[model samples]
Target: MKYPIMIRVKQKQIAQLVSLGKRLDGRGLNDYRGIQLEVGVVGRAEGSARVRLGKTEVLVGTKIELGEPFPDVPNQGVLTVNAELVPLASPTFEPGPPREDAIELARVVDRGVRESKAIALEELCVEPGKKVFIVFVDVYVLNHDGNLIDASALAALAALLNTKMFNYEVKEGKIEVKPGYKPLSVKNYPIAVTFAQIDDKLVVDPWLEEEQVMDARITITTDKDGKICALQKGGYGYFTTQQVLEAAKIAKEKAEELRKLVVKG
Candidate 1:
């Protein structure tokens, strides 16, 4: 993940600017880059969304299929999340099985959605123990500006919002599809905000240069009620107690702003 000599030089300059409460991109210390979101981008998928944050881009698709419930969770439906770091997105990415970074990205997003109770899985059940819907949320990273975790999480939630469940009928032990669809049952909105630290400066939604120069990064996911649902800290650096608390506050405010974009009619 080492950048060229010139990119590293730029990282130092960016750090210096951040120390002065400025960014190379002219955004405030706590400001996010421009974001654009679109839902229903993939017609074949039950649900899909694409999100762009500055130069980073991601797409998420949700597919619902009828499957047997897990033995331990027989009364509830299933939710699985997978993230792919496409090689075309960055030179650092390789084409193969999921790497450590990709696994971490998927787990963080999954933790946020699962902990927030965003989807009412119980309602997805068609039969108590035998039949239920399996929701597969797949995240594809199109660009690697900096914060893939936030962008992917947002796209996943938005896709879920746009999802339509296939109409189905259950008989003695079989389920049959009908000709209609209904909206997926969504309960809460959970959004993630990421902060990167360099020297003593903290910046929200760091871009590629800032990310490469950062010491550590922390991501806080908050629900609509302003409660922390999940927390993830990456890198070899650590955040102080006060810094973590301050990041939470920043995350809550920014999360509220981002939620509007997802739920927009």
Candidate 2:
């Protein structure tokens, strides 16, 4: 949600271009920037993925640990997500407690995966409620250009998909690791698409500049089945009914593209 002064000027120019049915980056209104994904980039983490959406970059790491399941979901495993906006990534981000923006980013990414039931928690249950495998997904912002939500979600999904859990045995209430590995029990693939409304023009995958001038933002999550799993809207700007419908259509299209990329790896 941070914007620079140069970005503000670019927004004005983008707005002018939007009025002419064009974008400053030469993309159509619903066009998305190029995406580059790399998996297993971090040697230390169990699983890791780095995503670059134009100038924006995000890294996600997945770690697995043995733990007890929640009381209500005794048969299901747990998945936790955390995000950090590193100071080194952006001058505006400070080294301290997480800000509200960071919290929101984590929650948004979590919702997309959790709500979609992408990971089959029941499959992670080792010994009912007594023992289970917990997957911890951490997202680190390496650079802030725009659309952190989408980039973070993509990174998280890719990381989880590539994660592997070690073989273990529960003996007399003590869990012990064996010498084997299994891919994480992932059920569905979820992808998030974000749209920003700039000067009454709804644009998909807003650059940093367009995000600064946009009135409101909308994010839609879709599963591999092409069903909407979650939706989140923020900012003070309002969108017309037609714009909302159009945005949904655009989201579905982008989701398909992202789904293919995630599955390819």
Give residue 187's error in model 1 in angstroms: 0.4
Q: For each candidate in turn, give its C-alpha RMSD to the true structure in angstroms.
A: 1.2, 1.7
Question: TM-score of model 2 relative to the true fold?
Answer: 0.95
Question: What's the distance in Å from true for residue 228, model 1?
Answer: 0.3
**lDDT tens digits, residue span 1-265, model 2:** 6666787777778889998889888999888789999999997888999999999999999999888899999998999999999998876889999998899999999999998999888889999978888999999999999899999999999999889889888788777889978888788899999999888888888877777788999999988888888888888888898988888888988999888888975
Candidates' TM-scores? 0.97, 0.95
Tens digit per residue, CA lDDT, model 1, 128-209: 8888899999999999998999999999999999999998887876788899899998999999999999887789998888
Candidate 1 global TM-score: 0.97
Candidate 2, clashing residue pairs? none
Give the worst 10-residue stretch by lDDT in candidate 1: 1-10
